[model samples]
Target: MRRFRHFTSSDSTSEINISPLIDVVFILLIFFIVTTVFVDEAGVEVNKPRAASSEDLEKNAILIAVTANGRVYQGGRNIGVGGVRSVIAALLEGDEEMPVIIQGDADANHGTIVKVIDAAKIAGAKSVSLATVK
Candidate 1:
């Protein structure tokens, strides 16, 4: 009876302190905000082909897209293969190890893809990958 009375006593503090929990949640939120990486897409949207061997790529890589009509876009600008070479050359000057990824529409011409890859290589891009959906 004494133990029950103690548990039921109004003098006992029964409120849960949530300040620490709130502080922890805020810290986690800030950490996620700082570590988040936003993917920047080229201006054009392409229906990427499906490939079973497709793999994830680094978020920092440059994205190049070839529309079904064979027009190329980079950084929201219409830059053809010639522009790709020049732009990639400038980018490689800053960071030679930067990778380039090409997003080609499923119905886009194969020749265009090859041309973009060749342009990237000519611009001193050590790593060039084709983007595809899995």
Candidate 2:
């Protein structure tokens, strides 16, 4: 007598196909990363005033800057002193809650900073703040 053995034409394996799931996860991650928006920097060289009591500000502010040479900037654009009102007004036209922050260089003229602050106020910015370093 000969021993008998079982054989099948089709082979079966118990394995889960997770390649599509992983691809979907990576796609979602890429979508989120592409859609996310971070705080936009003013993109200007500034010498912020130092303060032991300095505090962090919430993100998503309209950043303006006053340089040591009395140059005014909004998002790195040279908006002259006389242009602050119009430029800031345009920026705040439809956005009611967009806060304004002025980052004044330590050596910047105090009067210039004051003027910039005043302009921001005139532009209907309810919350205006100054930027400083610790």
Candidate 3:
């Protein structure tokens, strides 16, 4: 006589797949890169006044540059003194709290800087500051 035996065994394993998570991360990275805002540089040449303890200011500002020749510039474009009021008014029309920064050349006339400040104030700017290099 022969005896037969039957045996059964079960194997269990657990693992986590992270490939989908990695794909989602990459997609988010691409989306942010495409929608990110880039700040444009002010192309005008300005010889900023130097200060002993000048600090960096917020980049979200309206820059009004006064060259040594007494020319006024808004974002590097020549906007004459007569246009200063209008330009500043237009810029502050939507955001009255926008800050106005005057970048005056070291050799620029003091009166010109004063005029710029006055125009900015009349244009409804909440704050006005001078730009200086340290």
Candidate 4:
């Protein structure tokens, strides 16, 4: 005669409830998304001029780029000098205090850079600044 016994431990069947953990993760994701600060990028890359007194400006700004060939760019498109005003104006529609940062290439014509600045100012931007490498 032989006797066989089967036993199941309650601990072996217990599962960790991860619903709360998933909720926590979702909450954190939402928090980061809500608090994240996004920067407006200039569409073109430029060789920025060096500056002795260049200081950090606000992160969220209207970035306009001036290339070495005297082309103006914003959000990766060639806006040119004439498009600068309309672009800036549309971007600043809600925030009047939004700054305009011009990233001018070292070889870009000074006059072209000046025209971009003037256009930004005319678009009603309160703070217009030149972006330079320190």
Candidate 5:
């Protein structure tokens, strides 16, 4: 006499699918990046004078800086007095109504500031505002 035996086993493992989670994370990243508002900086720091009647200006305007040594700067580069007109004009090519804001140091020469203003005006700036600390 002879005997034979046969056995069969079945086991299944399940895993958590993270594809949806990854997709959601990517969507959130894109949403934050699209909603972020970037601001333009003047690239130079000046000792802005205090003003009693200073008002808040728009964040999307062009910024120019004049150092205490009467040197003109735009975006951290020394553009000089003669370069103001050309730079401003180039910036205002498409947006003629954009306002120009000047940040003059507390000890900056008044004449240099005036010249900057004049150049900005000639460059077709709709409005020019002085930056001051409140």
Candidate 6:
């Protein structure tokens, strides 16, 4: 009687298996896609002053409106000068580098516009700009 020996091959590989990593990445992508909140502007109608050289501004900016009556508004809601700082501070909590645009009525008081600018700066905004009509 002859004894037969069985031969087996071994997998001695040092490379990492990346299939699980790829799956995790895909799952994260899907989670972000589903859980991300998109902010859309919904506010009072502003009668923006018209300007011949007004350029188109980038959307999704922090708008601070100064009405002709010296009233301040943020996101279309009435916010007085004292409240401006707090509102801007709240908005900047997520992004301190957020841009602020002051949309003052052409007939609005210059002093009011200045106050808005000052409040925006105090709120830690990187850039504070005026909004002009085009």
- The sequence of per-residue lDDT tens digits that candidate 6 reaches over residues 6-45 is 8766866579999999999999999999987664341544
Q: Write the per-residue lDDT of candidate 2 for residues 48-93, one digit (tens) a residue.
A: 9888887777657888888899998877789878888888788787
Model 5 steric clash pairs? none
Model-by-model lDDT, in order?
A: 0.89, 0.86, 0.84, 0.92, 0.91, 0.79
Better of 2 and 3 by lDDT: 2
**In terms of TM-score, which candidate is stronger, 1 or 5?**
5
Model 1, range 1-134, lDDT digits (tens) per residue? Answer: 35544356677677899999999999999999999987777878899999999889755888899999989999899998779999889877877887999999999999999999999999899999999998
Better of 1 and 2 by lDDT: 1
**lDDT, candidate 4, 51-117, per-residue tens:** 9999997468889999999999999999889999998999999899888999999999999999999
Q: What would you estimate as the lDDT of candidate 2?
A: 0.86
Q: Against the true structure, what is each candidate's TM-score?
A: 0.71, 0.77, 0.71, 0.87, 0.81, 0.63
**Top candidate by TM-score:** 4
lDDT of 3 by residue, 1-134 (tens): 99999765556566799999999999999999998866533447788888888777655778888989999988778888888889889988877877888888899999999998998888788889888988
- The residue-by-residue lDDT of candidate 5 on 1-134, one tens digit each, is 78777665456567899999999999999999999867767888899999999999655777889999988989888999999999999989988888999999999999999999999999999899999999
Model 4 weakest lDDT span, ten residues long: 6-15
Return model 2's CA RMSD, one decimal. Answer: 3.2
- Misplaced by over 4 Å in model 6 are 1-42, 51-53
Candidate 3 off by > 4 Å = 1-37
